[model samples]
Target: MTSPTDPAARQLLAQGRLEVEGRLVDASNVTLYCALELDGLSGHAVYKPVSGERPLWDFPHGTLAGREVATYLLSEASGLGSVPPTALREGPLGVGMVQLWVDTTDDELVDVRPPAEVPDGWRVVLHAHDRLGEPAVLTHADHPGVRDLAILDIIANNTDRKGGHVLAGTDGRVYGVDHGICLHSEPKLRTVLWGWIGEPLPSDAVEKLRALPEKIYGSLGEELSAHLNGVEIGAVVERAEKLLSTGVFPEPGDDWRAIPWPLF
Candidate 1:
């Protein structure tokens, strides 16, 4: 199978024939690895149906697919382009989200090392002990792309930013996925990218935050309203405003668990 061009991929995701090839095992919710065909073009995509969503105490039931699309819209509007093109469409399972699959064949691991052994240029988030009771530290590469991801997570109010969610594309760019639990009305920003907490927001990130409110009210807000409630949309705008006002990365709060379970 050949990779589709950007425009063709977008068209396929938005309006294509989704054929479920198999299930992605061990996911918290039902996820399918599928083939998307449109106008003789074929490519791979991930499908997650609303009917398959597991109930969550914190989020409204069956809204995960919408949130996934919302994140893609927000990414495009914010000009971050870190999220892959995604759309809400009807698949074999039902109305679900279909996102163009990212190529991870050449991806590299974001290394985790003990604090004492960590090399230069790696940012440490916290210290802990391994299963064998040896000291270990959670770390991510201190790069601009990772920093951009940290900013994106903050704006999205992502509550499940696991380390595995960060992917490095073969094109030498980083991407984020699995945004079903993001953009909550409450402050639920749990993530592993706390490398720059309490630091000034990069100028580009700050500029994006300042312009996000405007972007939201336009097409992005309209698209999100279909999946998110008024309160949640308001909260998203509020979060953007707050970030712009503070002009700094936020520290993990003591009140809530700031890390996702099973860190990877």
Candidate 2:
């Protein structure tokens, strides 16, 4: 099968036959690991049935599957983040989100380590004491893709960018997943990728952000309307514009939580 980033992989995700292999027990909602086949091509994917979603007080308007697909669409349109090939479709359980699975490597991107033992080139995010009274620091690699994902989270208004959601794939790409709690028309952007706060946006990122508003107002807007409300769509454009005007990474807002709990 082709790499999940390829267009063919997206088509396969949108139109495929799935066989559930197991469940991801740690997920708050039902997450099934499945083996999927389409037109003689085979691959693995994660399927989340809408029927299994646990309602949240804050995000009570739509199914989590919609948010997942919407986030993927935004990432695709902006070319800022590496989101897997995701689609909403009928699965073995019911209608849900099906995303091509990424085979990740043992790469440690975001991590908590003893301050003295932190990698030489890693950017430190926070300095705190570990549970055992040991001095630990939160840090991440100064990688271009990781920074792109951080900026993507800002535009998408991602509310839950956990450390574990950042993956280093075997294909030599960085991916951000589990975007069920994103694109809210609110300023709730919790994430672990805040090491570049106050830094100027990369030249390439500035160009992409400038290009995003157009797509979000045109073809991308039509596609996103299926999952996001009009206000939510407008918020995305506004977020991009704000970032472009500022031309720098933002610090966490005081109105909401900054980083996800249990970072890893």
- Checking candidate 2 for backbone clashes, the offending pairs are none
- Return the lDDT, model 1, position 7: 64
lDDT of 1 by residue, 1-264 (tens): 434226677887888788899998978999999988888888899999988998888896338999998888888788653887889988898999888888864544355677788867888898898888889999887877778888888888999988888888765778889999998898999989998888898888878878888878887788888888888888888988888888888888888999887787
User: Model-by-model lDDT, in order?
Assistant: 0.83, 0.92
| TM-score on alpha carbons, each prediction | 0.94, 0.98
lDDT of 1 at 108: 42
Q: Which digits, one per residue and each the tens of the lDDT, describe model 2 over residues 1-264? A: 557867689878878789999999999999999998889888999999999999999887677999999999999989998999899999999999999999999999999999889888888999999889999999998988899999999999998988899999898889999999999998999999999999999999999999998998899999999998899999999999999999999999998889999786
Candidate 2 accuracy as TM-score: 0.98
Backbone clash count for every predicted candidate, in the order shown: 0, 0
